[model samples]
Target: MPIGKLYGIGVGPGDPELLTVKAARLIDETDIIFAPQSKSGKPSVALNIVQDYVDKRDIPCEIYQPLFPMTEDKEELQRSWDEATDVLYEKLEQGKSAVFVTLGDPTVFSTFSYISSRLQNKGVEVELVPGITSFTACAARAGVQLTEQDDIMVVVPQVSEKLTKILPYVDTVVAMKTSRHLDVLEDCINQDPRQKDIVSVQNCTMDDENIVHGFVDNKKYFSTSIIKFRK
Candidate 1:
């Protein structure tokens, strides 16, 4: 029997229209859908993004959201990954192709990349299809270009000294997962004369999405900041 292929499909940030034509087609044709949820039974954001594109009338597809927890504990993370891999492996063994929906481009801070590597090691053929990233979407929506001319751009997933070090040398800084380290980020950017250029966008392109002009004490979980420097 022929084996099935696994596609790590990037579902973009949130809006359904941002989905690539290829990503939409695969969702419609795949035998099963895999989405990464923060908890065991929570709905996956990536899965929701492609709902309009999936067709189940003639060909019904199963949707499975395996838990990919948000934690710093290594043992817990490994266990979650292992469990998710086992589920995918089972589908592959049944000759059922799958679409693993991801929030942004699969290569950048996406759990799909780690899971895809595991599936490959298990001998399952995997393909990655790119989609729009959140930063670019936020920039376009806010009318703020990420970079221009010879402007330097940096994308950081978390708060760290690296961001501070680069503050003096870049034109744009996109800080993801910024809620926890708001203080560190605030102090660094506060030192810059271009502090007014910073803006935090929560939920990017989603219907309930919001864009704040500057730093705030409370921020939503799915927030990221775009800071434009003087070039």
Candidate 2:
């Protein structure tokens, strides 16, 4: 039997309704669904966003929660990716189509990207269904424009010393996963003499979402900061 196709579906930021029509249709048709959890016992946010669709499927759909730990260690991360790939490959080898749900766009800083690359190398067909990104959702919720005519925007995965070099070249900067690096972000922004406006949003589009005009010492994992420098 030919290997079953694999899908990487982006479930959007936090709202269930934000799932694209294509993503919802695949969720209902797939034989198995895989979602990544940062820890063993914690619920997968991506799975939660699509639970209703999964529950409404006429045929029973299997769900798999693989642990993808949040760490910077390359070796540990590679091991985890390999294990997850093995699990998916076994299912695909049996001709079972699978869907992997991820927060935001699957191609943007998502664990699904790593898994998809491995599966593709193993001859499994891969398809991606794009969804709204968190930073765009945050900007909408906070009523901030990302960019205007001829303006440049840069998206940073983490706030770091490199931001100082980036600030002078872009009209807008979206710093994602800002919870752990708020101090470093503040320092970078302070160094720039240009007048700037900052908006910090936590848990964008979720029920408990918070949007602040200026930076705060936020430690929420889903926090994002949008910095706009005056021209």
Candidate 3:
């Protein structure tokens, strides 16, 4: 039997309507779907975004929620990837195509990157379908332009001291995963004299979405901040 292929689909930032046409079609046609969850027994956000499409599939698609723990430990992360790869490999070898759905663009800070690399090393063909990123969606929701002509932009996954160094060179900064380090981000913004505007968007495009004009005091896991600086 011929080995099946794997597709890494980015479902977009918390909006079902944002799913790309290709991604939706692939999810509908794939033999199985793998959605990653940070904790055991918890529903997957990526799955939730595309659940409607999954339900509309003509043939029932098998769904698997793989645990990809949110941790900084490299060893622990690698172990989880190894396990997920094993499961995917077995299905692929049986000629069953699979789709792995991610919260945002699969290439941007997604667990699919690790799994796709491992699958590629094991000789499994993999394809990636890009989706609207959280930062872009947040920028739209906040009504902020990320950059203009001759302007530089930088996207920081986690705000830190490095953001301070980056601020001097870039015209715009998109800070993702800001819930954990809002204090550090606030300090960086405060010290920057050229800071023009800042907006924090929580749960972009979701029903409970919120937009703050300045720095956000509260923590929200899905928060993204768009910061602009004068030239």
Best by the lDDT measure: 2
lDDT ranking, high to low: 2, 3, 1
- Runs off by more than 4 Å, candidate 3: none
| Candidate 2 off by > 4 Å | none
Arranged by TM-score with the best first, the candidates are: 2, 3, 1
Model 3 reaches what TM-score against the true structure? 0.97
Q: Which numbered prediction scores highest in TM-score against the true structure?
A: 2
Against the reference, the lDDT scores of all candidates come to 0.85, 0.92, 0.91
TM-score of each: 0.94, 0.97, 0.97
Q: Can you write out model 1's per-residue Cα lDDT over 1-231, one digit (the tens) per residue? A: 666899998888899999998988889889999988997667888877887676433677898989889899999999999999998899889998998999989988998878989989988999999999998888888778788888888998877777777777888889887887788888888888763587788888999888877765565777888888764
Model 1: lDDT of residue 160: 79
Task: Name the lDDT value of residue 215 in candidate 3.
Answer: 76
Q: Per-residue lDDT of 61-108 in model 2, one digit per residue for the tens?
A: 889999899898999899999999999999999999999999999988
Name the better of 1 and 3 by TM-score: 3
